[model samples]
Target: MEGEINRSVHPIFTRDPEDFMQYLNKQVSVLKEDGKEVTGWVYTIDPVSESFVLLSFTDDKTQLDIVMGPSVRQVSVLDENSETYKKRIEAMFRPPEVEALSEEELEKRKNVLKSWLLKNRLPVQVAGNNGELLSISDALFIEPPYGVENCRSTNEIILGRIQGLIKNMPSDQEEWC
Candidate 1:
């Protein structure tokens, strides 16, 4: 009932190194003429079969027959069950939380927000005072790394405490995070 859906969308790539790109223009023209063009959204294009894709926003599950450079292939569709679909959608790009990551997950709350709200926002790299790349890798490594931190100043205090806890670690260990 729950699994990744990698529906094929026709036009998959082929192994012929020499004839690979020969059918490209024709394929595009066909898809366009048929009004079956890929909708404007991000879909994972298969490297070998450029036609195959994992489309996430279709209205329903169905296979598409696509004419590729010089051939046609049937791509299969694997729709996730509703429950699994909802969960996957929810977990997509979430990152670990700092104060809470110390535990496990942390639901985003109304009170919790980004720190960038109160602080000055700047680009990742402009010349630092030294005119060199000011690697904000620290911000990158810290939980909630970079941008403005959410939570109260107390959350910062907690983060500082965690940092203190790591103070005694060996330099090699400390180099991490």
Candidate 2:
């Protein structure tokens, strides 16, 4: 909840797309005008209309819900899972591979990946910079992959490590010191 926004007070509908995009890919507890609460990972925000695309996973199925901006009363970020969620969203709608993509196409993909990682506060190390790693507290460094399948496997491994870490962490009361 580091950067929680109270939409009732701030009027998110009137905010710019850059502001709305801040909530993208993070786990959030959203309160609607009708008083109903919904929790999910933010997938994206429509710049034109400021609507939120949220993703919720249950069992084997994944559900995507769109909450209109005007109806949102508040949005409280639950956790920072933006990087993982972004990867999930990308995998869902990724375009088929072309035999030979142009330089511009590669650059575009790189920029998109870099932007998402930076926005999510995920640590990243450029592939060809002598392989020198950059470390951030409580952050994991995932190597850039060559293809979609490799990226998916890397994500799964990272997720598994995260789950294991969560399971081993001290409880709230124990960390009060």
Candidate 3:
């Protein structure tokens, strides 16, 4: 009977990492075997087992819940988080301890940040021998120029958009190129 219910809901347990990645940092409704619903922002998905970790925040405190891979009946993404909410989530989950950085580490981080800024074509000004800063507007609008390259098939356009979205996601750890 439970197996029947799970099959009826959705086969979420067998989904791939990319499929599960779509729910990350977004509010979702998870239907359980007993017909109860749990809703929260998806924190992470276990790539090996495909289980889900959800986080719920209240005025007084925050709560974290884990739903086993086989027990997840169905998942429906509810809403996307705003930039402020994304920052809050990142800060909340950041490691509690702050380690003193060595000069080598500081130099490496600065180089990475500079490379990222240059790749994005953001206006940057060198501040000193070892550091740089950039002044940005509260909102910057960019209008993509339409051309033959922009006129792609629906499927192609959608794939490109998805790839771009994935590329723009924040990484907690440093990625070496």
Candidate 4:
């Protein structure tokens, strides 16, 4: 269940990419079975270890601020010097030495996790007033298998603010944006 917008920026609670990757793979598997929509990928600071990751959203860039206690601002979104870009390119070329999980095994593991997530996860509504496929900013993906509570709070906040912004604007003004 989602709630109304909170315009203030929320503090980033955490930034554990490996944990996110596992959860994503699992969620994707189960969602695909039931034909649910989700965006999934492995995000890494070291592209050299991860492999075969096709780079999408190269044009994507946004400021990320982790404000749980202190303000650690991060420039999120993918770029040439961005972590995603670095890992993806290195992942593309990294050979047999640094593979984390076998592709087949990773897929299987994801299936199991997806099944579990489908059972325990809570629904957090995310919508874009501009009515776009990628308009979601913040959504509470119920704590995953390992109790990672704020897995996506940062993104959810950004998307939620955008939604709030769109809702208050005039129809014609929306198109001009």
Task: Score each candidate by Cα lDDT.
Answer: 0.32, 0.59, 0.56, 0.32
Query: What CA RMSD would candidate 3 show?
Result: 15.3
Task: Give a tens-digit lDDT track for model 1, residues 49-120.
Answer: 444222243466433333342232333223323343433332343454433343212212211211221122
Two-way lDDT contest, 2 vs 3, winner: 2
- Give stretches of model 1 more than 4 Å off: 1-43, 46-113, 123-177
- Candidate with better TM-score, 1 vs 3: 3
Error of 3 at 24 (Å): 0.6
Off by over 4 Å in 3: 1-15, 82-84, 97-177
Q: Whose TM-score is higher: candidate 1's or candidate 2's?
A: 2
For candidate 4, give the lDDT of residue 16: 48
Q: What is the TM-score of each predicted model, taking all chains together?
A: 0.20, 0.47, 0.48, 0.22
User: Could you give me the TM-score of model 1 versus the true structure?
Assistant: 0.20
Between candidates 3 and 4, which one is better according to lDDT?
3
Candidate 4 Cα misplacement greater than 4 A, ranges? 1-98, 121-150, 155-177
Put down candidate 2 lDDT per residue, 16-107, tens digits, no spaces. Answer: 66777678779888899999988889877877656788898777999888888788889899988677667666567544442245545554
- Per TM-score, the best of the predicted structures is 3
Error (Å) of candidate 2 at residue 132 is 23
Candidate 3 displacement at residue 131 in angstroms: 18
Global local distance difference test of model 2: 0.59
lDDT of 3 by residue, 15-40 (tens): 55588778878898899888888888
Worst 10-residue lDDT window, candidate 4: 63-72
